[model samples]
Target: MEWRWNAVFLVSFGVVWAAMTTAKPVSSLDPADAETRMLAALEDQYAHDPGNAVLARSLAETYLDLGRPGLAIAALRAGDPANLENPMVAHRLAQAYEASGRVLDAYATADLALARCARALGTADAPSGTPVPRFACDARQHMALSTHQEALGHMLEWGIADPARDARTEVAYDLALRRASIASAR
Candidate 1:
């Protein structure tokens, strides 16, 4: 799913880049020198190797940098990112949608990206035979920890947490109880 979206984003972004180069401001020489240069370069690239994906991605990123969010997103969307809804793609798509004044779509994409991140974080630490997926500790362990819990874990683990004013202390204690409950349940 993620790979598919990555490809679409790459392509859409590439074409947008090529277009941006062509769409550069007017030049003095022959009036169309910039256009010609842009086209020639794009054509040269397209002709040299239709299978040059790196070039294509570079072109797409270039388009994104040229303030042509529409073209860049389109190029990227042409691949799996549009269909797959990966977090990175969702993040970019949200950006593009926001730039295009599509507030709702932007919000939606942002939400999806957040959800994907959360989901990934949740299932990252699964024990081999546990009823529920385990949390990965120390960034290497994958666990479905809540935001507060995760913060608490990091603070406690690192010993930098202030006992007097930390909101996460209670959260950590609650999580401990929950873990105990789960252990007993199992």
Candidate 2:
């Protein structure tokens, strides 16, 4: 039993030592160089697994962080269309579209995301009766509303005069107001 215990300890110590020695220290690299390295690694992984939605999203986010919204759009498009149903993917794609001077596309994409959120939460249309304050506090609904608001802001900033955009903006504003009212009531 003593020998067996000693052997186990030695093996665990060796593994830990090997890991500590082999791991690269992140603090040693310059911020820009580290970002470039991370981007290259993610790109390589993406190239090997082109259909990976998570990888595609990561690459898109990295490109966005680097101020390359066009590249971000390309990265997002490289993945499966089904991935767009993911709120994060839709939000990022909308941002990329807006940054690339496609305000209408951004608005449409955001609207689609909001619709998805509503469908997922089974709140496509509010109840016809008295409103429940708790309904306004849903996190998913807040995310959808915020994304829609952002898209509307971009459209308004671009001076695009469209009734659809105006209506969506008003809806987002109302949702936010309701959320505030609910919070204050609590």
- Residue-wise C-alpha lDDT for candidate 1, range 1-186, written one tens digit per residue: 999999999999999999998885664335357854774586467446544444445545555555566865675556433232334445556556545645455556655554555555554433234232121123221122233234334444645334335565556557655775574577
Model 1 lDDT on a 0 to 1 scale: 0.50
Task: Give the per-residue lDDT digits (tens) of candidate 2, residues 67-106.
Answer: 6898899878877776676656777797788667677777
**Model 2 TM-score (2 dp):** 0.57
Candidate 1, residue 101: Cα displacement in angstroms equals 1.3
Q: Tell me the lDDT of model 1 at 113.
A: 52
Q: Which runs of model 2 end up more than 4 angstroms from their true locations? A: 1-32, 126-145, 149-186
How does candidate 2 score on lDDT? 0.67
